[model samples]
Target: MTAAAPSATMRLIEASTMISQGAEAKIYRARLHPPAASSPSDPSAPDGCVLLKHRFAKQYRHPTLDGALTRARVAGEARALVRCLRAGVRVPGVRMVDAAAGVLGIEWVDGASVRALLGGGAEGEVEVEERDDGEEEEGEEEAHEDGAEVALREYGLTPDQVMEMIGAELAKMHRADVVHGDLTTSNMMLRRPSAAQPAAELVLIDFGLAYISTLPEDKAVDLYVLERAFASTHPQSEPLFAGVLNAYAKGMGKDWTPVSRRLDDVRLRGRKRSMVG
Candidate 1:
């Protein structure tokens, strides 16, 4: 849906469009233009557009608990994304936060999800027959960094490359003491730097389920979740996953050893700790 025209106070005036509606929140796309030199400056100096995640009040939840949880999660997500950005991990920058309102505005990314970039799962490819028969296919094929369907048919990137990007980006996030609780392929996006640029980079998003923890166990479990996601979604993902771990190992430096050992143990036992009364 379109937002009304901008008022004096709204940075995102005319910038709001719904992205998704979930049990907890509704996401909106907010267009944030760089302030004209004459406009009043914000400390953040927000330029370009951003994705605004507004956690709506859940009538079903107990008001007190809902308010507390919603506020906590909004803050947690903003904090994690900010930490990842500071760590040089490719994450959307937080431009504004209204924790009480459960609103978090982040850098608007231009790309496709890693899942769509990789041709996997029930999500099918684009119809090739739709193309004009006389028109030749466009340009040299490059690796699809955006997601599955486009990545496979259009970008021509192999599964291994996607895995490597996943590994490296996760490692970077972990090194910053951030743990992405829901480490799924769908949560990550591949960002093309520019239309003319050949290179593309991985961007971690959806921090609503994330938190900060420096513990090796937490980090290992994070990797384990991603590994499980890869194995279940893509066939013959062992070597591809190994490549991710390798890149992660190199990027993690001294912190890699402990987390690596814990990851092996987690693989043997599974994601959760055994419960004993």
Candidate 2:
């Protein structure tokens, strides 16, 4: 198959609306598939909206090398998402890929980031909509609106339950030998369940730093990062994190022993480094 040239049609980019920008890529809300106005019966066509991640040009690097680097990264991210999907991890599905332009489109998850849902402010904190002055101001909201209390009412789950889901998902991913190099609450989402799915699901996102690895140490480090994230963002959830590990251990089944030991080692090393610094 002939690969699309660097100048290939970038209608996908043209249709996208930039939503947020991070160090590695600019994200946009876009439609991957052209409207099936002619053939609504097309079985291969996917959803209307998609999230596009574009790794823009870097002026510092030489043009040829930069283009190659960008393409490699886009491919890597797409591969990671596919790997998670096969492993039954609730990651957004990839819809389109334009490696030449360093753009990768994925399913647009329609729900709140776990960060915002947990009172961790928001992931990017970009204000998109304006509220009326008559609307309740920020301070007027009850204290229960702070964290998981609202989740209990809306999602019917508490912080502990969400933590368990996070742990189980991480376990499943690690069991599939995919180590998420960056595991943080901000990198997860709570997809609101629909007719297809009955209950809300915890979905891990931003797999830009993910890689395949079978090593227990790598998985342990991943768990360690998740632990620190919980401690920092939802301090009250720290105690319940043991329950998360128990859930993870149950999910891991026979593979839990070694990862558990390695996690202990990682925590010790982390404390030592903190003390030294």
Best by TM-score: 2
What tens digits encode model 2's per-residue C-alpha lDDT throughout 81-107?
898899898899888888988888888
lDDT of 1 at 262: 95
Cα lDDT of candidate 2 equals 0.80
Q: What value of lDDT does candidate 1 attain over all alpha carbons?
A: 0.73
Name the runs in model 2 displaced over 4 angstroms.
1-9, 34-47, 123-146
Off by over 4 Å in 1: 1-15, 33-47, 121-158, 195-198, 236-238, 271-277
Q: Rate the local accuracy (lDDT) of all candidates.
A: 0.73, 0.80
Positional deviation of residue 234's Cα in model 1 after best superposition, in angstroms: 1.8
